[model samples]
Target: MKKFLLSILMGCSLLEAAAQTAFTVNHGPYLQEVTQDGATIVFTTSRKAFSWVELKQHDAPEAEAVKHFNSKDGLKEAWNTFSLVRVEHLKPGTSYDYRIISKEMRSFQPYKVVYGDSIATKWHTFSTIDPQKRGGSFFITSDMHFDAAKLEKLLHAADYRTCDAFFYAGDMTSYIDKFEIPFTSFIDTSVKLFASSVPFEVVRGNHETRGNLARTYSSYFPKKNGKIYGSCLLGDVMVVMLDSGEDKAENHWVYAGLNDYDAYRTEQAEWLKELMNTKEYKKAKYRIVISHFPMVMSQQWKDEKEWVGWEDAIRKFLPVLNKGNVDLLVSGHTHRYFFHEQNVDGNNFPVLEQGESSAVRLELHGGKVQFQVIGVDGKILMEKTISKK
Candidate 1:
C-alpha cells in the first residue's frame, strides 16, 4: 500500500501542480446514481487507469480517486477503462474510513499509467447511510442519462446528504456502447457526492443493456444475489432487483428465443420463487420490485422472431410475486413517468414509472405502504397508498 500510494503521488507530481486538478475526495462517487443496502456497496467505474498498479485506489491521484472500477473489458470501450470495486458485508449503521485500493497493477508497457513510481492514493472517510430512518430518510430515482447539469441540480435540490440511502430505478446513461466523456465523469464526480453522505442502489435500465452490460454491471457493484435475480434487505424494506431481459422489437415483438434470455431470467425467477416464500419476506413491512422494463398483464409471446413468447416466462414469474404480495413494481423504460394501479391476473401491484430527475419515496405504516413521487425540486408530484395487508 505504501509503494502504491507513492507511485500515484509520483505520477501526479510529474504533471505540473499548476495544472493539476484538486480532487474533491467525496465529491462524485458514482457516474450513475449510487446504490447501497447499508451493508453492500455498488457504483460505477470512477477512474481511467490503464495498468493495474494505477488501478489500486492507493495508486490513483486524490483528484482522480474516490472509488473506481477497473476492467480489461473496458479496454475495448471508452479509453479502455473498467473495474468497479465492491466492499461487502460492511457494518450496518456505522461509519468507516476507506482508502481506495485496487486489486493490483499487473502491467505498464504500452500504457504506463505511472512511469516507474507506484500510485499511493489518498484516503478519506464516509459514514454508511443508515437504512432505518434514525440517521435519515432515503430517496428513489433513476434515468439520468449522464445529464450532469440535471443530476447536479437534482442532488442539489434533494440535498442528497439528508437521506440515508438512494435508489435508482435505472438508465444512468444515454448509451452503453462506449463510455462517453462527461457521462462517466458524471458518475465519477457527481455520484460520490451523493453517496458520500448517503448510499444508493441501482437497477439496470435499457440504456445500460448494450455491449457486455453484465460484465460492466458486476465489475463495479459486485454482490451475490444467490441467483440471477437478487434481493437486498434495507431497513424494513426488501428490494428485489430483477434481470428482466430486453424489451426491444427484435426481443419483444419479433419471435424471440425462449432459451437465449433464459440464463439471466431463469436464475432470477428461481431465486424469486424461494425468496417470496421466505418468512422474512412474507412478514416484511414493505417489498418492492425493480427492473429496467415493466411487466404488464399476461402478455403471451408464444412465437419466434417475436420475443413476446418470453412474455409467458414473465407470467410464470409473476405468480411468485403475486403470492409474495409485492407492494410496488418500479421500472424505467418508456422514458416517461406514469403510474398505474393494476391487478396482474388477480395479483394487485402498483407500477411506479421512473422519469429523469424524478424521486419517489415509500412511507410505511402498520398495515400498508404509501408511495409519493418527488420531482427534482423536492416537491411531491403524486402520492398514493396501498392497503395490501
Candidate 2:
C-alpha cells in the first residue's frame, strides 16, 4: 500500500510540473498609462490562459493583497493570450508590487471546461505619480525604426537610474505588419527595460500608420478616449502627446485613398484648443508637447511638392498651440537632432529632437527642467536648460 501511494504522488508531481512549464509569459509585465490614481499592466502568455494581476501596496501586509482581474473591467471570459489589467483607486504617488497570475486553459466550451494548474510571476514594484512632488526625471527616445540593438544600447547607456517614466516620441517600428516580428521586436525590447517598473508612453509615427496591420496599433497601445492624442499629468508638468498623421498629403497617391489625416488633424487641433482652456492646463506649472513630427523644419525639397506634409499641421495646430503659451515642444521624425530656440517655429516655445543614435534625459526640479541629449556611447551630444516662465 505504501509503495502504491508513493507512485501516485510522484505522478501528480510530474503532471503539475508539466502544466507549469506549458504556460509561460510570452511578453511583457510592462507598465502603461500610469496615473496618480491608477495604472494598466499589459502582458501576453504563450498559451490562451486566464490571467490577472495580484498586487498590493509595497509596504502593506501580505494578508491585504488585492486581486486585479481583467474580466471585472469589461474584458471577456474567453481564452486569450494578451491580458490588460487596469488597477484603479490606488493611492497617488505610492509604491506597489505586483505579480502576474495565470491558469492554463486546456479546453473552453459551453458547460464543459478544463484548466491546468495556476502559476504566478515574480513580484515587481512600481510607484504612481506623486502630484505634490517638486522634483522628478524622465527619459525620451525616438525614430528607432525597429532597430532593437540600437534601442537596447541607448537605454543601457542611459542607465535610467533616476527615471520616473520613459517616452518613445515615435517611429519605434517602421510599420505595423500584422503585429508580426517587427512590432513584437519593438514591444519586447521595451518590455525588457521599463515594463516592469516605470510608465511607457508611446506616440504614433507616420510609419506606424502604414501596412495592413496599421489599424491594430491601438489594440496594443490604447489611448484615452480612443483618440491618438491626449494629455497626462506627470507631477506638476502636463505632458501633451499628439499624433501627427502621415507626413504627406491625404490625397497623395501613396496613401491609396486610405488616409484622411487632414480632417483628423483638424479634429485634434480643436481638441487641443479646448484642453488648453481647462483648469488642468492652467494649474500646471509646466506644459510640454510631445509629438512625432515638428511644426517647423528647415529642410526643404526642390521636388515642387504641391502638398507639403507639414503644411496642414502648421496651419491647423500651430496657431492654437502658440496661443496656449506652450513652454516646450519635443519631437522626432527627421532622424537628425536639432534644437530650435524660442520663436523659431512661429511659436514661443523651444523645440528639441533626439536623433536616431541618441536619447533625451530630462531632470525636473527646483523650478528648472534640464535636458541632455546622450549618444549611445554614453557621451552628451547637447545640453539645454529651461526654467519655469
Q: On residues 1-389, what C-alpha lDDT tens digit does candidate 2 reach at each position? A: 99999999999999998877677987888887888888889888888888889889996776787887876467544498878888889999899999898998889998887997678888889998889876567788988887888888888777775677788888888887665544464678877776778777888888888888888777676554676678888777888988888877777898999988888898899899999999988888878888888876664632446446667776787888888778778889878788988886586778887788899888777778788998999899999998656
Please provide TM-scores, in order, for all candidate models, with all chains considered together: 0.67, 0.90
Say what the RMSD of model 2 is. 5.1
User: Best candidate, TM-score-wise?
Assistant: 2
Each candidate: RMSD: 9.5, 5.1
Candidate number with greatest lDDT: 2
